[model samples]
Structure formats: structure tokens, C-alpha cells
Target chain A: MKLGDPRKAYRIAQGAKVRLNEDDAADMSLCPEGGKNSTQGLFDSLRDRIQTLQKVLYAENKRRVLVIIQAMDTGGKDGCVKHVFSRVDPQGVNVKAFKKPTEDELAHDFLWRVHPHVPGNGEIVIFNRSHYEDIIAVRVKKLLPESVWKKRYQHVLDFERMLAEEGTTIVKLFLHISKDEQKRRLEKRLENPAKHWKFHVDDLADRKRWHDFTGAYEDLIERTSTDYAPWFVIPADRKWYRNLCVAKLFADTLEDLELNFPERDFDPSSIRIDD
Target chain B: MKLGDPRKAYRIAQGAKVRLNEDDAADMSLCPEGGKNSTQGLFDSLRDRIQTLQKVLYAENKRRVLVIIQAMDTGGKDGCVKHVFSRVDPQGVNVKAFKKPTEDELAHDFLWRVHPHVPGNGEIVIFNRSHYEDIIAVRVKKLLPESVWKKRYQHVLDFERMLAEEGTTIVKLFLHISKDEQKRRLEKRLENPAKHWKFHVDDLADRKRWHDFTGAYEDLIERTSTDYAPWFVIPADRKWYRNLCVAKLFADTLEDLELNFPERDFDPSSIRIDD
Candidate 1:
């Protein structure tokens, strides 16, 4: 199969019912031949394509792209963003990691803090964690009531629709990892002193409530997967496959923009630079 | 008359045709009971009220206020922002000056740069020069064709409407200074070595196109002013009156929100700290 051909298998269809447990988190059916070792070359090529496309997007200076990565703790959001976008120009791409809301942020509507960070023209913005948290984390943690969280599904849809109409192409990715894989990763973090800071005790608390989170995620994906902003579920148990899929998804999405260098508005041959 | 009562006199009615030359740049009909020397106390009081209201705004943290100031070159945008908001807490009030567009900024839609600097919840953001520049400056300089800049009127209206519906209180001020006043200000800048840095030869180029800019401003204000985002033409020749008017405008705007410190989410009375 071609590198980008399997993307549809991972994308949750608009209006389709989603069951997180039904999807195989470790599935590598789309992996290229010689799986792990040979994947590096493919990943590098995709990264190079992303870099070239991003430069053209910058040169064209018109369209915007927003990439949102959502994953459970240890599901590799940071790792995925780092590996996939490492070769892209830092100036053209902005990565915003949404942490716990500040006192000021909690006071406004959830979308208030988010609106300012959307991409400008000729830019790509990556949300490490995003507005989806207002739905998923709020529901799972009972941060707000059912009514409040339930209403946000529509709010998110309306907001994303508006953004799409305003010339932003949005892609959301949910990294899927099995519960056993999460446990193994947690163990690996604990085993190494170098990774100790990465192992948060609160992550264990989140793991305990895994089923609640999964239910919330499933509901959100089903509700918010629209034509403008679709959700992709990447099987992330294998780090290499996850990276490859994400890189390919970005490359394919940017290529679809059909971006090219903007035509020079002036006749370059008639101009002379005086020293 | 009360400090804020005459604000309506300066506000351009929605859908009203504007003639910049007809408005008195030195008019002080809305100025306080006293002239410039005796106006210090009232201005101080207004500043104090602004500071107080800003604190409550910070504490409440639910609404946003955006102040957009537009003017010709040497029209005192910086001075007005500095004097009017001097007493307010810097943390709660953000002032963003939109200068010339970088190559990256020129690549996208006109509103792209402006959207990112808008006020957050409980924040009061001042745009030293704003999106109006896209209409006024672009037209005066013939940077883009009439077909391009003319469409921006509707774009701005729609964009501001969205912001207003999303809970931002919008106040746009056109610091209305006479052409003569601008010439005087420019001369004053050139006379003082300390102020020479503020004067630029390019400003003379803009001054030469004064009639073009005035005409453009009239058309934009006539077309784009809405009930949600009204434009107030401040008589800006008298620096003291201008500052007083702006201070009163802000204080009155924040007061209308009826902001109060949020009630404690957790009861302090129920818990005691262990020493």
C-alpha cells in the first residue's frame, strides 16, 4: 500500500459511531515492508516533504493549517510532534501545549483562551493538547457538570466550523495505545532515573480512570468528526508506526492544499539594486 | 456635565455618514466644567476609577474589552494609551502596537495579525493602531486596489460581530486631529533632538496624502461602525481633553460590565490552615 493510502482507515468518519475498544491499538497492517528498521527512510522523506510544503505555504502566505494531537498520558503526544515535525522550519510552525487551566482561564468560556492561538496566514500551529480537553478531561474528571460538558460538543462543532470557513484547515489526531502498553511505558519510565520526571504520579490516577476517559473520547470523536476537521485515530502502541502515520497524514494534508510560491507582483527583470 | 455623559456626542451613530473635516479636532464640548489647567482633578478621578474597575475585571475574569485607536501620523495614539491607562494594572491591560506589516504578515488575510492580539477574558487590550489601518492606509497608499480594500469593510464587520458575540466589549477610537495640528506636531518633533527619533521623512509622505486618508477614514467609519463595535471620534488637538475623554470612556465601559470579584469556589470559613 502507498504511504498515505491507509489514512482513511484511521480517520473516524463524520456521523459514524465510534468505539475506542474496537480499534486495535497495536495494529500494524499499514506498516511498510521491513517494519521498524526500514521505516526511518520513509519517515525522513515525509518530513522533508512537510518541510518543503511548509516553505511554500509560507511563501504563498495565504492558507492556514492547524494540527491538534490528543492522547492519553504516555500515549506519546510530545514524542509524536517532536519526531514528525523536527525537520520543519521552526518559524513556520508553532507548537502550543495546553496545560492545566490558570485561574484566569477558568473564568472565561473555554474557547476564549483558544481563539487567540489559532494560526495566521501561511502558518501551521500544532496543539499538543487542545480544546478537546474541555470535553474529554472535563467529563472524565467531573471538572464540570454533565450539562456543561455536553453543551461543549456543539460549541466545539460551531467554533471549528467558523474556523474552517475563515480559511483554516484543521486536523485532529488521537493516538491510541492499549492499556497494557500504557502500563509497560509507565514501568519503563519508573525503571530509568533519566525518565523519572516524565513519570508523574498523577498519570497513575488518570490510568485508573482509563475507561471513563475512553468513553469520553469516544463520545467526542463521534460528535465532532466533521468534514472540515476530521479526527484520525493512529495506532500508537508501536512508536515507529505512529510517527510514520502522523508524518504521512501531515504530508498528505499539506499536499492537498496545492500550495506553491506566490507569483511576484512586480516585474523583477526591470528592477535594479543601487549600492 | 458628568465625565462620561457626553461620550455619545463623540460616538458616530451606526450607519451615519462621516465627514472628517466637519468634526472639530479641537472641540471640547464634552470636556469637563473646567478648562485644561483645572481639568487635572477630574482626569485623575477617572484614572482612579479605571484602575479600580480594572482590578475587578481581573478578579472577575469573565469578559474581555478591546480598545482600538486609529489616527493619522502624529495623532497621539501612544500618548493617549500611556496617559489614559497609566494607573491601571499592567498585568490586566495589554497594549499592542501594530506597525508595518512584515513579509509574513502581508501573506495572510488582513485580520490575521489583529486577531491574535485581541483581549482575553478579564483583560483590556489596547490596539495602538489597528485593523482600520488595513482600510485607511491601504487606500491612502494605494497598496491594494479599491476592489481589495473595499471588501475589507464587510470582513471587519463580520469579524468584530463574532468577537462581540463571543463576549468582547469593543470600543474603537479615531483620534480626530486637524491637519494643521499634525503639521504642528511634526514640526515640534523635528525641533527637539530628543523627539527627532519619533519624526520620520516617510511621515511627510503620508501627510502629503492627507486628503486621501481623510476620505478613506470617512468611508470606513461610515460603513464599518456597528452598535456592537462603535467608533468614537475623539477631538484630539487638546492633549488634556483627549486624555480625559479616553480615561472616561474606558472607566465607563468597564463599569457597564458591573464586574465584581468572583465568589470563592471553596469556602475559606470552613477550613483552617495548620500552623
Candidate 2:
């Protein structure tokens, strides 16, 4: 099964206006004729390829990869990562899930905590939810005035631009799931005894303001997506397809680096082992 | 196969004298009678158990675990972590490797950079090298005066004591290997083309000053090991045995927590989802 180019299919073009409501949450247009069943083999291969590429990246030790994933509740952000990068070495890949800021974190500049977590040389760092929360959640919940949250779009762009210029490759993904699909997922969580710990009452409050959240995402993606750091709107309503697309997107991004293991400086043939 | 109690065998007694040269790097006293070959199944089970307990810890969202690993070059710090915690969820476990202090890091207090990376609630953090370096490396290399490095021991104790009082569990491990074993590992790295990237000429300088490093370690461990945050010295010449001991130590620590999935405050049966 041939996977379509995720860069072309999903990436939000720079300066393009985005409409979340108009986008298909269950789009499988990029999937091959065999659809989800046949794509499992491709997905597995992509994960293996990603693992191999990550090793080369780690060995190269000159560049970094930053993956930012944003999603509404039950949009499969966690599931997508679990399926896609499951094969990568945990030592090289770090997942940072940004929760509500503590008093100490809130006292600092918005990017202060985030700057410390950026990928060092030869590392892949994934931001599960990121500084965008300061813009999106704050805007929708009125935690900050429009004038305050409005400046963050430029601040984020500047921050990402600096990261990119400093040899960091950036990929931002928005797990796009429909409101109806979220309701189905929420209901499933409520029905399962084991999953109740994951179901929070506050999630219901976010669900009630779906349009506001979507609008916030649309604005953030439109304003933030750039040539340096592109935003990909992943159709996440279908679990299998979402995983496949994410795997392919990540593999494609890493391959573009043309990574290679570092050449040995000393002659290995001349070295002797006394053991 | 009965694995001996690691806590009883390896943990340094508070206020006790320590001698690095007296410890056996290849000691298998903790290993079961059946030895390395028999411990594979046990190792696999411990990894699984750690994974399960970590989930409960994440769900409980009350306590934190901090694992500190210290070792000489090629003493199997990375290898031990890879084998022991391979099954842990990457989302919950964070490994921070401290390399040479950067200009910015040197400008701040020793613990300032480390303060931000401590485990958050429901998280497990592993420090590949830690604030101990500020003492061990500084004293051994003569980077700081005796008076300056000596005071840091008290600072670290105060820092860790506060973390313990605030519901963070601390476990520190030092991987002990002999000079002959270090020579073998360094030679192996030079002999293998694939491992040449892991080798450095500076490692030889450290090896030449092995006595200095070990002496610093002895003094630091003797002074710093306390009831709140104790240190364990693992025999590490045998890779399999080192992994087994570390795995058992971690699993035993988590079991002491008696972790359970948190109960939902909202009644699951009463909660309804409109689909």
C-alpha cells in the first residue's frame, strides 16, 4: 500500500486561512486502495524506519528534532504517539506533557519552562501539549485579556524560528477529531470501569465550549504555521489511519535530514582488545 | 532462583565508612544459585511489574520517584537503565543526563539547573549523573577548592531532604567497576567500529586518575548517604548481574509504595454520556 505524502496532504500552508469546521476529521484520502488493513504493514515498516533513523540522528549528534502535538480531549494525541514511535529508543526520545502551570512556572515568562525542555544535540523531544496552551486555553477561558494573549502568536513564532535556526527540525501536529467522535470516545471511557480514572469532569466543561476551542486552534495554526515550523492537521477520528499518517509523517521528516552515523576518527583496525 | 535482598546487601548505612577498593565489582552474591542464565525470566517479570506499578503511580498522582545513577566512564550506567526500565512508559519516565556544565550552567548555583528537572507529581525521573558530579568531579579534578566542594555536600543533603519531606522518594545507585574492568571496556569500545563514537581520549585521563575519582566517591558516599535518600553501590563488572540488581532495587522501591489505581470521586455508574 502506498502512503501519500503527508507534507503535501496535511501541512497547513504558510499564510493560508484555516477552517477546522470545514476540514474532514475522518479523512482517509491519503490511504492507499487497500485502506486500513493493508496499511498496518506499512505502519510497522515506517516505525522501524523511524527507529533506525533516530539512531543515526543520535549518532550524528549535530541536529535535533522537536515534535509538538496538540489536540482536543479524546483526539488521540497519546494514542498516536504510542503507536507511531513505539519502536524508537526511549533514551533518545523524550515526551514532555505540559500540564497546568504551577505557581512557580506561571511566575516566569511563558517560554522559560519550555526552553529548558527543548531537544539537546542528537535528541528527539516531543511536546504533548505546549506553549500554545497559553494562547488557546487562556483565550477561550478568558484567563488573560485579548491584548495579552494576542502577542503570544508572534512570541511563539519568534521562539520557534530561533529553535529552527539553531539546527532544530520542528514538526507540529494538530490531532483533528470531530465533536461527535469525541462524544463517542467520552462515552466509551464512562462505560469502562478501568478507564474511569482517565475521565475527568473538567473535560466535560471543555466539551461544552467546542466551537470556542476549535476557533482558537484555527487561529493559532493559521498564525503560527510557517516555512520553518509547519503545522499538520492530522485526521484523528479513525485510529488506524491516524497512527499510519503520523508514523509516515515522522519518518518522512527524519529522512529529510539525510542522517548518517558519525565516521570514526581513529583507525578501528589498529585498535587491540586485551580481553 | 531466589534473588537476595538488594536493599540489605547494597545500600550504604547512614554515617558508615565506605571503601571503594573493598567492594567486589564482579560480586554475584546477590544473584540466585542458577546465575545469569536463570535470571532472564525474573528480569522480564520485574520490568513488567515496574511498568504496572508506574501506571498506578501515575494514576495516584500524589508521590514522585527519583532514581540517581552514578558511574565512571563505561561503567554501564546507560546499559543498566536500558535493560531495567525498558518496559516503562516513556510519558512518565524522564532520564536527564548531565554532561559538562555549559557557560550558562556554570554561572548559576550548582543545584539551580537541577532544580527544574526534578520529578513532578506521578513522574519517575532518572539522573544519569547528578549534583554529585559537582563534588566528585570537582574534587578529583581540583576544579574547586576543598572548602568550596566540601560545603556542597551539605547543600545537596538539604535539597534532597526537602524533596523527601515533600513526598518524593529517592534512590541513588553507584555502579562500581574495577580498574581492570574499565581497561577491558575502553579497549572494547576502541576495537569496535560501531562503538568508536562512544569513546573519547579524555576517558584515558580519567582512568589515569582512577584512584582520585574513587577516593572522592568514597568520601562523598560516606558523608551523603542518609535515611531519607540513601545510596546503593552495585557490583557492575557483569552486565547481566548489574541489570538484575538495578531492576530488583527499583521494583522493590515501588512495591514499598503499595501503589493502587486512584478511585474516581465522581460515580462512574451514574455518569451518563450523550452520544
Candidate 3:
């Protein structure tokens, strides 16, 4: 039950997926409808801890954190980034959302564009979607030969190793949503007029290739979960649980870094006595 | 007294310089240290309102906001951004801090580097220091020809006019602190063993040129205060008042935008009965 030592813990979490049950699901649903009163106590308590750790971890320990999130559509990547990071000290955090590569990015190697945006010392950087996209997109569309796509796994591990050597701690999360849950969510979007804006034919296209995408993800989790940068497969069927796990992981990492607040010095006796 | 209007009120506030009396200063000092209690009430009432308004403003009214901040070294620009924006919905807001130009940025016109970061429709962008740096740095170090730097005022005015025509609302703040206060803060930093790393020799060089910098700031504020993007001179000697004024301006602006949450199609009765 203890998620100890990043690499070993990651493997156990991944393998323990088959053992996940209703209790975990119930715990995730701790967040209630209003999203205000129901979860306020948990988030508020954690928020204070996060603030204190952030100040110390950033200004003193100066550890750099890299968060990698890969998920199926409507799996709540945006929501996770926003809500979990709601209490972060922004000065030491940078969130980068990578979409389709621009022409300039195309000019360089895949890792080149990503290198510059990596968190500096005592900083936290979140990649909404990252280099893993290269594997997913290429695998789904057959954009590359099998040999070519397979080679990228080693390249990624090596890239992450470089980052670890440079003092970057990486947390990669794969939001695992069931096919049936996805279908229900998609139908809800289609049934509503206002929500129709979010639905697209391409979503259905991706769903049709669900098996291939799952295989790609399975391979991804197996191949790239290294000692330096490990992956967590979080069940994202319920959003409340997703937020809790993500928040816990972030706080735990800062605790691992042993954050301390910067000390202040002032002469208390310098003030004049009252007449 | 009304600092809310975009035109006439700006002119009036610009004409009058108000100083806080000792009693007023004493009363305002009671505002929370570190911005925790100072703006608590304001945040509680306006948090939900701002959230609902953000989406509507993004979809319907679509106004762009450009916030320009001017301050001395360690005047809390970073702290203000971190605390004041801690509650905002990020989909509509962006923060840009200007540092020394990179090689590519130096090759182009200085404004060229800044023009790209300006707010687009439905965006609220914060500029930590802005194109006015050309004037400030140039005036102090004589980095550019007087003719070139002087001409930038007219250029900046024209650029802002273009943004206003395109629906960008501008807010500029100059965080003003006395030399005595700066000396006290800097001396405290030097005396603090924990803060030794934060103190840089370069900062002392800038502090020695305090008179020159103040003169430059006076001229820049006098000339650049206009109907559009008028500057609010805030007392930086007290951090709480600065946060209060900034929060007030933000709340008032969103209210003016009249943002409302979109209606969801989910059946209210279905949930009510089940619950």
C-alpha cells in the first residue's frame, strides 16, 4: 500500500490496476456536487500545506518538478491542472500545454523544443501533453514504421535520465477511463445543446481505434516507466478521485524534498518605546 | 473619487494627487500582512462572480485586458502576481514578465519583442515590466539615443490606441516606495543570513542611482498618464494596500463586464428528487 521509491512504487501501482475496487472509487467520489462545501475541508487543509511547502521548496531547497499528464479526451487534463494547482505559488511554477508542433518546432529534434521549457531549480513545470504524444499519434495513425516508432521509447528514457541528472523530478500520470464511461460522457455531450460545441466527429474516430490506443498506452507504461521518471495510472472515471490522487502525489513529492521556509532577520528592539 | 470609469474619471484622478494622513495610514496598516486577511472579504464575495464572468467574457463580450506594473527591485511584483491572481480562472488570464532581452529579441526593435505578448480578444494579460523599460533603462544608463527613446512615448501611445480600438482594456500601476523604506528593506536583507543568496551586488548599483531612477519614473509617469491605461500610484511601503487596490480594480472591471454563467441542460428535478 505504500508507494515508496519512485520506480518500484510506479511498477506496483501499474500492476495493481487489476486489483482496484469500489472502495477506491468511493474514496475518489469524496468531492460533492456543489464542489464548494463538500471538498472544502480537504482542499483547504491541503492548500495550506501546499503553500508552506511551495514557499520553502522553491526559495530554499530549489527542487525542480516536472508533471506529465497523458489522458484520453474529456479525461479532465485541463480540470486536473487547474484544480490541483489552484493553490500553487505561481512564481516558481510554469505550466506548458503542448499542442500540434509549429513549423519552428518541427525544425528541431523532438526533445529540443521541450528542453528550453524544463523547470529551472526550485520550479514546478507541468506538461499538459508531452513527448508521449509522438508515440500515441504515430502508433494510432501508423505515421511511422514499427521499427521507427519502437526506437522512441529508448530515446524518451534517455531524455528523462538527462533531466533526472540535472535535478528534475518527474511525475507522469495516465488518466485511465473505461470505454463505457467514455461512451456515456460522449452521449451526454451530444444530448445537450450548449455542450454540443465540445463534441466532434474526430472523437468518435479515436474511439473506434480504442483497442489500438490501449495497446499503445500499455506499451508506453511498460517501456518508459524508468527509475528516474516513473508513471502512475490513475483511474479517471470519477473526476473527484482524479483530483485527490494528483494533489496527494504533488504534496508528497514536496515533502520528499524536505521543503523549508526562508528565514527573515530584523532587529526587534529597534522600535521606540511608547511614551 | 471614482477610479472606475475609463475616460473622464481617469483625467480627474490624474489631476489630483492624494496623500494618506497618519490616521489613515494607521488604519490601513491593520489590513493583513502577506495579503491573507487584507483582501479576504473581497475574495470571498467576488471569487464565484469572477469564475462565472470569465467564461461569458471569453465567449460574449470578449474584452482584452493589459495590466502594466512598475516597481523598484524587490517591490513585490512577483508576490503580487502570485497572491492577487491566486483566485482567478486561468482560461482568460496570462502573465508575462519581461527580463533582459534574449539575443533574438535584441536583434529586433524593442517594441517588436513586446508587441507579440499583448493581450488578444477575451484575454487579460499582465506585463510585469513593459516597453516603458526602454525609457527607464535608457534614461538611467543612456542605453539608446535620446531622440529614439523620446520618440517611443508617442509610439507607445499610438500602440495603446490601436489596442483600445481593438477592445483591449488597459490598467497600469506604479508601486511607489520611499528611499528610506527601500534602505530599510535592503539593509534587512543583508543582515538576514537566510536571505544572503537573494542579495546581489547589481542591486546595490541600482540603489545608488536612486535619485536618477526616481527622476526618470517621475517624467515617465507624468508623460504617460493618459485617458487610456492611466497609471494608479500605489503606496508600496505597505503591501496590503497595494493588493487591496489591485483586487478592487479587478473586481470592479469584471462587474462592469457583467459576466454570467452559462445555463446547463441537466435536469435539476432529477437530481433534487434522487438526493
Best by lDDT: 2
Candidate with more favorable, higher TM-score: 2 or 3: 2
The i-RMS of every model, in angstroms, reads 15.7, 2.5, 8.5
The regions of model 2 sitting more than 4 angstroms off are: A21-23, A29-44, A102-109, A263-275, B21-23, B33-37
Model 2 TM-score is 0.91
Clashing pairs in model 2, backbone N/Cα/C closer than 3 A: none
lDDT of each: 0.82, 0.89, 0.68
Model 3 regions lying over 4 Å from their true place: A1-42, A102-109, A143-148, A187-197, A259-275, B1-39, B56-64, B90-92, B100-108, B112-123, B143-145, B158-168, B180-205, B226-228, B255-275
Error of 3 at B111 (Å): 3.8
In DockQ, how does model 1 score against the reference complex? 0.02
Instruction: Give RMSD (Å) of candidate 1 vs. truth.
Output: 16.3
Supply DockQ values for each candidate. Answer: 0.02, 0.38, 0.20
Model 3 error, position B42 (Å): 2.5
**Between the candidate structures 1 and 3, which one is better when assessed by TM-score?**
3
- Per-residue CA lDDT of model 1 for A121-177, tens digit only, reads 888888889999998888989989999989999999999999999999999999999
lDDT head-to-head 1 vs 3, winner: 1
Q: Chain A TM-score of model 3 versus the true structure?
A: 0.81
lDDT of 2 by residue, A6-113 (tens): 789999999999998634998999985988788878888998899789888988899999999999999998777766765576778899999899899999989998
Query: For residue B193, what is the lDDT in candidate 1?
Result: 47
